[model samples]
Target chain A: MAGEASSGTFLQGLERGLAVIRAFSAQAPSLTLSEVARDVGLTPATARRILLTLEQLGYVRTDGRQFSLTPRVLALGWAYLSSLDLGELAGPYMEELSAATRESCSIATLDLPDIVYVARVPTSRIMTVALGVGARLPAYPTSMGRVLLAGLSSSELDVYLANMQTEQLTPRTVTSASLLRAAVDQARADGYALVDQELELGLRSLAAPIYNSRGRVVAALNVSAHASRSTPESLCEEVLPHVLCAADHITTALKHRGHL
Target chain B: MAGEASSGTFLQGLERGLAVIRAFSAQAPSLTLSEVARDVGLTPATARRILLTLEQLGYVRTDGRQFSLTPRVLALGWAYLSSLDLGELAGPYMEELSAATRESCSIATLDLPDIVYVARVPTSRIMTVALGVGARLPAYPTSMGRVLLAGLSSSELDVYLANMQTEQLTPRTVTSASLLRAAVDQARADGYALVDQELELGLRSLAAPIYNSRGRVVAALNVSAHASRSTPESLCEEVLPHVLCAADHITTALKHRGHL
Candidate 1:
């Protein structure tokens, strides 16, 4: 409905078009006209018009009946990624963290109520999900999520808590807003966050916030280790140092370059 | 101009908004409203409204004058990548190819006249550019580009050759359309493409095309190596076999799963 809102300054057609794109996910990659309209809360006629525009723009393709996106849509994301020097700066640090911990390392930033991965250095892991850049996870169950949540201002945190829904992904996952707030506060105090089997049953991760030159947390860095190989305490003791060291170095480099 | 065209079915606002997004590239990532209007050929007032809409949608952020994109825009690309089973199917094969060749392996698809990287398996190298998924390179000077170009139908190839400009990145680069067509034809006949120091000074690459269940070429796979480490002949002899095997295996897998 937010996208459907039209004002003098807000382009409803553009918003609805983007909504239609977002309506397609991994589970529902292709959709018929009515399906797209229903998913994005647009009329079939409007959806058809937007789809036609997208197809003309080379961002989408339709096989007569079902409409889907094309790889050219990636240029949109690249515009954002290439604009920032964060990913380029963080790539080496992420690689070093992955090397030191012998595990996967990733950097993510907060967006709305979820944290979106901006950069990653992956290891061949058995239990980890195959994820790449632009992958999203909820903000209350993961270590980076907590660090990012702690970075938010009180008003922003209030909006997030008001809008987000919490589910128990694992038994260790915190579901209540108060508990989530407490965890965020703890992360803020410690300058790091650790989650043990909160996202997955056998996964433990430790994360530290990466501050920009302005002392704002622009992103969070995390080392994800399998529980069979390391516990939260061990992760804190062994991997946290590397994570913090990388965080500090990244911050110093960003400050020197004024990258953020 | 194409986006600004409005028909009964084509939504002008939608195309214009997407054009605004595409106007920002790696070189001019952050642009002023006037610059964006000039780049996309829109009025200043129209660009402002579209930028306002994008900013409201959390895709673009403006620091008073210069407007830049946000990571939330990745969902547009994610919609396309998630819709395709290509990445998940090709990830392991790419990893194997990278491991076997001790070089970088990547899978890319033809989008318009460019090759957009969909998935990549990287090796830590000294001279290679730090590229990730969603990176684009012109489809006239590289191995994957030649393979993808070869995959296009005759009429499709005609449109591409007519529209795309060839640039001489290096002295070895073929700038003539006839030469490019010859290379593409050679790639098609050989079932692979190899380019030696055409795109870069000391880089060599070998590529193979992957087809779908219906025998349509969908993506191209390639192995990138350094000239100091491997020659074009060596790339063909040592790395090309692995690339073809992986390409064949990926095609078979996609066929079995009807994944394309």
Candidate 2:
């Protein structure tokens, strides 16, 4: 509000439009006119106006009486993807790790207090991790998030740890600041992290930081498996090595491409 | 513009703010105050206004006098990627094909006039086709795009082809609508498409339609190789079989997951 008030020319409509678009999701991909109004906390008339504008821009589409997102909404993602070289540089390496380990692999970039899975490769096995590209997991308890956090400066990590809201996701989720700091410190020392059954009941993951040419961690690469399939020792001994190799390869490629 | 005007209550401020955000890119990851105005074709005052508003909303950050995008932009892409099941279901198959051929493999859903690469697996050795996960390519010439187009009903294809603008990217680019239609027809008849030197010289690709449980082609999967490495015949003989099998695996997985 300070920035907007100081600049003195805020675009309230754009903010509302973005808010309305964000209101629809996996559980509420399709919304009736009244539902959109209720979800966005706007009057029905105002919500209808925003929806109509979004529909015109090809960001929203309607089926009969309910509104749903159109594929054109992908343009927003395209804009970010096209502008970022990290994904391109890390792609092959992620593929290699997925093949070598025979498990689902992913790359995530930290987005505030959560980690957003930006890229994922499933291994054609029947496994449930409840994580997908763009799916967010609390940073305190996820392997990829912790690996990414390890790269942050000490002061930045302190701030993050201070703001972290400890919640019980599962019995394994870390809730204490001192414990979280120790986990992050271990990740910093070892160059990898393992999260077992913290976010999901049977999910386990091993992750290593994917560094840019500057040796800064811009993303984290991970291998996720069901608890039955991947033991803690096996994942660290076997899967982590492969993932680190792949991350090293990706970092070299990024350096060659001048992404440093 | 027509769509917005018809709606009778358009948000011009939101449009201008989004345009300002879109002006930044990988090369221009951070921009000075004047640079933002130049790219978006707005006055510096107007650009400053939008930028300030965005900063207030946590979408943009200012470092001294320069402006850059924040991780919050990922929120927009996260919205789309999380809502769609295609990218998650198609990941492993794409990785397998990439590993087998040592080339980039992609899964794309058609957005008219363009195809957005929803998921991709890049091969380490080749950097020629390093399209990122959410990059977009012209639909008229890409192997994956044509395969998806071939799945559309005849009337739908007719309408799409009529409005398309084909820019010649290479000597082999299909500039004739009828010829392009014929190619689509051939893909429909054969259930696969091979496009060589159309979008990029020395690039050859093979693609197949990926059907959901209801048997609709919701996406297309493709293997792209250097022309010198793969002849059209070799692609058909070596890659087509695996492409088809990977597609079948994804389709079956989608059904089991109830994504269809």
Off by over 4 Å in 1: A1-6, A125-129, B1-7, B125-129
TM-score of chain A of 1: 0.92
The true-versus-predicted C-alpha distance at residue B254 of model 1, in Å, is 1.1
- For B129-217, candidate 2 gives per-residue lDDT tens digits of 24654567888898888889998988989999899999899999997889999999999899888999999999999988888777888
lDDT of each: 0.83, 0.77
Name the lDDT value of residue A109 in candidate 1: 84
List clash counts for every candidate, in order. 0, 1
lDDT of 2 by residue, A1-260 (tens): 21222214666666777787788676776788899999888888778888887787777777657886666666665455445555555767776788899887888888779887666666763222245445677788889989999999999999998998978899998989999999999999999999999978899998988777678898888898899997999898888889889878877787787633
In model 1, the Cα lDDT at residue A204 comes to 92
* Model 2 lDDT at residue B15: 66
TM-score of each: 0.94, 0.76
Q: Choose the strongest candidate by TM-score.
A: 1
Which residue pairs come into collision in candidate 1?
A: none
